[model samples]
Target: MSASGLPMRLRVPSDARFRPILLTMARRVAESVGFSAADAAAVGQELAARTDAVTRKAPLAETTPIDVTFDVANTNGAVFRVRARCGGSDLEVTRPLPLA
Candidate 1:
């Protein structure tokens, strides 16, 4: 669980092949917030796209451990945020722009 107790986390080796697992995790998180199955899946794909892009370019990623954290918020209605972290770097995706 995450700080808000409504999060799911996956820790895996920093390898491209494991990206799918992370994406699956994201999809489930999105659906938890009421996204339709297809929309939730799209969110997962987007999360994977951004995460893969970041991890591929991260320094020493091939050897670093990565942690993907998924969270859903209900404060102002449903919102989702996912973070893929390696060492001190963070790659994050969130629904509903903070300023929107």
Candidate 2:
């Protein structure tokens, strides 16, 4: 809590070093969408695996640094936004995420 006694919230900027944390968040989202734990785990596994494959197969210079954001709200459905800025241009994309 802050000095005012309100709950504190934390923010994490999406970066290469935070991939593992993002993977966990994705898994939790999957589970909340009515997927069984096992299924959610599988999805998370595949997400990580695919990310690894891309990193290994692509040249570093050809890849762009991307950011991920998880926006959770009571009145609005969750939103997972991924943005990549590279090649002298900024690309922003947003996806709707559901919580069961």
Candidate 3:
């Protein structure tokens, strides 16, 4: 586990089957960044929706590699960011974090 509130870079096959794993990781990262359980769950849901939207707009081959990066290292910052890139399409989502 990263002490810097979930700084992760993942390269996974662009398959819908991997969504659950991604979502789980997102939620865990959120929790590590001081989000309540409910908030973490919401983060996961939002991440999933954003990912789906990105894929829908620019579809990728199942075997294509998707790069997902979670940037929560700036725990003092006001927002957390998640970025996903696949098939030349990029999606970035930012969510506000609870104040310390």
Candidate 4:
């Protein structure tokens, strides 16, 4: 992971069915990068919910794909940025994730 937090990417089909896989990846990445256990879990849970919400609202075709991009805004006190995009629709959420 980068200085602030997230440093990963996940791409999956644009269906709601893939949310669990995304959550698992988010949790593992957050924890591996030194986020506190609870914080990591929270981040994962929040991401999953947010992604699902976005998916539900988006008018995506079944063939379209979704992408989850994790990034840090800056090297110092950077916030974790989660961007989910599907079928040209997108949603962004940020978190000031805590260090372990």
Candidate 5:
């Protein structure tokens, strides 16, 4: 939820790829909020620990494509914005060569 009280959503085709991008952005945001890299990592580590428990379960078989969106707010507590969705089949994948 944002400062104004709106739900944030974010989607990814798979949790594996989504985590890195999210973590990077979060680290940056934490730094902006006066957190050092070590601090950010510590926070991130805790979050990852919790998330790991949830994601360890199987993926949603029905949805190979994932969509994620978020309601983001600035540090000033004003100007709430929604970030673009960042997931789904948009990720590039190389086709395997056929066996001879």
Candidate 6:
């Protein structure tokens, strides 16, 4: 896929209720970039886990917004990255994408 639609950013409430939506969005982005179904799901899970850790360390207000960014890069290999930020806390997760 082209990079035109890349570098996407999403802002969602910090409530745990939004976790599923976040995970599904992460999975869909991974799949759009050629990740297998299982791999995409794994990526989503990893993002959720990392975000959880960050939020736990620095608790955010229920109405606080978490900004999630998704991007793809090609260096030695294709790589997908997800970054989540809330208040003063931030976390990033990366997964290698399968070569086409």
TM-score for candidate 5, residues paired by index: 0.45
C-alpha lDDT of all candidate models, in order: 0.72, 0.46, 0.78, 0.73, 0.42, 0.85
If ranked by lDDT, best first, what sequence of candidates would result?
6, 3, 4, 1, 2, 5
- Tens-digit lDDT track of model 5 for 12-57: 4435656665556544444444456786555455444444343455
Error of 1 at 31 (Å): 1.7
Compare candidates 4 and 6 on lDDT and give the better one: 6
Q: Which lDDT value does model 4 have at 8?
A: 73
**TM-score for all predictions?**
0.74, 0.46, 0.80, 0.76, 0.45, 0.89
**List of clashing residue pairs for candidate 2:** none
How do the residues 1-100 of candidate 1 rate in per-residue lDDT, one tens digit apiece?
3436477788877777777787787777677666778877888898778766766565555657778887766667656778778767788777851222
List clashing residue pairs in candidate 5. 9-69, 10-68, 10-69, 11-67, 11-68
Clashing pairs in 1: none
**Overall local distance difference test of candidate 6:** 0.85
Candidate 3 lDDT score relative to the true structure: 0.78
- Over the stretch 1-100, how does candidate 3's per-residue lDDT look in tens digits? 3555555888877789988877898898778777899988888898788777767787678877778888764555667777888888787767887788
Per-residue lDDT of candidate 4, residues 1-100 (tens digit)? 6554445787888666777888887777767666777877888888888767766776676656778887767646656677888776777767775654
How many clashes in candidate 6?
0
Candidate 1 has its poorest 10 consecutive residues by lDDT at 91-100
Stretches of candidate 2 exceeding 4 Å from the true structure: 1-16, 61-63, 67-100
Error of 3 at 77 (Å): 3.8
Using TM-score as the yardstick, the better of models 3 and 5 is 3
Best by lDDT: 6
Model 1 residue 74 lDDT score: 65
* 1-100 per-residue lDDT for model 6 (tens digits): 3565369889998888987888999999999998999999999999888777777777788878889999887777778888898887888888887878
* Global Cα lDDT for candidate 1: 0.72
